[model samples]
Target chain A: AQTVTQSQPEMSVQEAETVTLSCTYDTSENNYYLFWYKQPPSRQMILVIRQEAYKQQNATENRFSVNFQKAAKSFSLKISDSQLGDTAMYFCAFMTHTGANSKLTFGKGITLSVRP
Target chain B: EPEVTQTPSHQVTQMGQEVILRCVPISNHLYFYWYRQILGQKVEFLVSFYNNEISEKSEIFDDQFSVERPDGSNFTLKIRSTKLEDSAMYFCASRGTSGGETQYFGPGTRLLVL
Candidate 1:
C-alpha cells in the first residue's frame, strides 16, 4: 500500500510572500504520479498542479510549482507571490503510473492561510 | 471546459437507511472514482469503476457499499445501510485518457448520517 504524508498541519504566508508545503510518500512502485489539490471555503476540490515520477523537471503553473525529489520520495508545493485567495486546505495525492484502476491516495492535508 | 458533476450537494439521513449518491463523469472519460473525506481528515479512496464494472476498491469500501454505472453518463454509489461514521463529503472523479492522466473532480456531495 502507498501512503502520502503532509508533515505540516498548518501554514501561513504574507501576501506577496512565498510559502512551501511539504509532502512525502511511501511507495514501492517506481513509476507513479503526484498531485496537489486545493479546497477552499466553497468545499470544491480543485486541481492545483501535478508531477510525474519519470520526469526530473518539476511542474510549474504560474504562481504554483513543485519540487519533486523522486529519490527522497518528496514532493513539495511552492506558492510564489502568494495572495489572500491562496488560503485553503492543500492536499498531496499519489497514484500509480498504470492507467487502470487509478485511485488517488491523499495526505492529511495542510491548511494554508495568506495574511494581508 | 468539461467537468465531473455530482447531485445532492448535501444529504441528511438516518442510520440504517439507504442513500444513493449520483455522479456524471466527463463524457469521454473511461475511468471513474469515488472518494470520501471525513471532517478534518484525509481524503480516502473508496472505489474505482471502469468498463461498467468496479476495477478496484479499498478496505473502507465494504459490502455495505457498491458502485454502479447505470448509464453512459451516470455513475452512482449506493450505501446499503448508513452509519454515523458514514457522514462525510463524497467526491467523484474521472480520467479522460489512459496512462497517467489527471483526474477531474466534482464539487462533492456532503452526506450526513444521523
Candidate 2:
C-alpha cells in the first residue's frame, strides 16, 4: 500500500511571494506518477501539476513547479508569485504507472493562505 | 474543455436511509472513480470502475456501498443504509485512455447524514 504524508498543517505566504509545500511518500514501486491538486474556497479539485518518477527534469506548469526526488521519496510543490487566489487546501497524490487502472493515494493536505 | 458533472450539489439525509449520488463523467472518458473526504481529512479513494466493472476499491468501500453505470453516461454510488459517519464530500472523477492522462474531478457532492 502507498501512503502520502504532508507534515505541515498550514502555510501562509504573502501576495507576490513564493511558497513551497513539502510531501513524502512510501512506495516500493520503482516508477510512478505524482501530482499536486488545489482546492479553492469553491471546493473544486483542480490539477496543478504532475511528475513522472522517471523524469528527473522536474515539471513546470507556469507558476507551479515541483521538486521530485525519487531516491529520497519526496515531492515538493513550489508556487512562485503567489496570488490571493492561491489560498486553498493543496493535496499531494501518488499513483503507480500500472497502466490505466491506477488509483490515487492522497496526503492529508495542507491549507495555504496567501496574505494580501 | 469537457468536464465531469455531479448531481445534487448538497444533500441532507437521515440515518438508515438509502442515498444515491450521481455523476456524468466526460464523454470520452473510459475510467471512473469515487472518492470521499471527511471534514479536515485527506481524500480517500473508494472505488474505481472500468469496462462496466469495478477494477479497484479501497477497504473503506464496504458491502454497504455499491456503484453502477446504469446507462451510457450516468454513474451512481448507492449507500444502502447511511450512518452519521458517512457524512462527507463525495467527488466523482474520470480519466482518459492515455496512461499519463490526469483524472478530472467534479465539483463534489456534500452529503450530510443526520
i-RMS for every candidate: 1.2, 1.5
lDDT value, residue A47 of candidate 2 = 98
Give the docking tier of candidate 2.
medium
Report per-candidate DockQ.
0.80, 0.72
RMSD in angstroms, all models? 1.0, 1.0
lDDT of 1 by residue, B1-114 (tens): 888999999999999999999999989899999999999899999999888889999999999999998878999999999999999999999997855379899999999999
Interface RMSD of candidate 1, in Å, is 1.2
Per residue, candidate 2 scores C-alpha lDDT tens digits across A1-116 of: 89999999999999999999999999999988899999998888999999989888999999999999999999999999999999999999999844446899999999999999
Q: Which regions of candidate 1 are displaced past 4 Å? A: B98-100
Scored on chain A only, each candidate's TM-score is: 0.98, 0.97
Error of 2 at A108 (Å): 0.5
Report clash pairs, candidate 1: none
Which DockQ value does candidate 2 get?
Answer: 0.72
Q: Looking at model 1 chain A, which ten-residue stretch has the lowest summed lDDT?
A: A95-104
| Residue B61 in model 1: lDDT | 98
